[model samples]
Target: MKDRATVVCVRDNRILLVARERSRWALPGGRICRDETPNEAALRELSEETTLAPIELTYLFQFTGFNTLHHVFFADVAHHARVQPSNEIAKCRWFVPVKIATLSASIPTREIVELFFRYIRTLESDNVHRISQQAERVSL
Candidate 1:
């Protein structure tokens, strides 16, 4: 499978979506470079496209679709990046989840984007359960 990466940087509950120079709306990233790890490639592409380094970046998962293997990542930045598309992207801008549905995203791209929200919901639920358990243990 082809190796690609989608770099998602969130600021103010919105996601930074990069419009490729000649393609539709997507994240600020590209295909994996030779001998480059997913984190390395993500950092490089995010910097190249947005000119901002993330304070924290983590791998979300690997999405295999559209004849390519996509290494997806989520980043939390201290500041909202003012992005100017580099050689790969034509434009970049932050977007809320609602706006995402209206954008011109690829089929697989939207699927992955939606997955993040689901992940967040699941994570929050799990955290709540863990906290409750911890409270019970403390009271015991």
Candidate 2:
């Protein structure tokens, strides 16, 4: 399977997606170069495709597709960040998670997105639980 460095850029609860002419909208990313780590490739591909630099980039998890192993990364960018489609990308847009099901997107893109949101919910739940535990301890 080919290894791809995929970036999921989020702002205002929306995800950034890019597309080439006649291609389905997909996350901004590309194949990982032999000379670079997945982290480096993720950043490079994001910049190359969207011309939007993220304020923060974090390694998420690996997602295995039919023929691609996606090294997924999460990126947070300013809400006002302007995206210019560059390189081979013909267009760029942000879409809400709920809207993803209606769009023409790659299977990997859709799966990765759904998985990422679940991961986020898990993190949020953990944080809330920790905070509640701390509060109970303080009360006791």
Candidate 3:
């Protein structure tokens, strides 16, 4: 199976997506090249497709598809930054989380977004638990 790394870049509660000519919209990513780690591939693809680099990236999740294994990451970008598509990309746009379901996106794009939200929720819950434990320690 091919290995790929995708970045769900978030800005103002929206995610970045790219579409190639006559293709459905998808996340900015591509197949991992030889001798490259997933994180390295992700950063490279993000820049190649969108001409915008991530402020930071956090590993979100991974899943195996029929012919590919996807390693997804979360990135935060500034809202004011413009996404200039490279030749391989036809167009790039940002969509709010709630609007993603209505877009003409590939199935993998939809699945990846769902996973991204789930990962964010998990992070929030973990942070809350850590805070509560810290509070209990202070009370002792």
Cα deviation of 97, candidate 3, in Å: 1.2
* Candidate 3 structure, TM-score to reference: 0.91
> What is the lDDT of every predicted structure here?
0.82, 0.94, 0.88
lDDT of 3 at 119: 78
Tens-digit per-residue lDDT, 1-36, candidate 1 = 778877777778888888766678887777788899
In candidate 2, position 105 carries an lDDT of 95
- Expressed as tens digits, the lDDT of each residue in 1-140 for candidate 2 is 99999999887888999999999999999999988999999999999999988888999999999999999999887788899999999999989998988999999999999999999999999999999999999999
Kindly list the per-residue Cα lDDT of model 3 for residues 17-99, writing each as its tens digit.
99999999999999999999999999899999999877788787897777889998887766677889996998998899878
Using TM-score as the measure, the top candidate is: 2
A best-first ranking of the candidates according to their lDDT comes to 2, 3, 1
Whichever of 1 and 3 has more lDDT, that candidate is 3
Compared with the true structure, model 1 gives a TM-score of 0.91
Using lDDT as the measure, which candidate wins? 2
Clashing pairs in 3: none
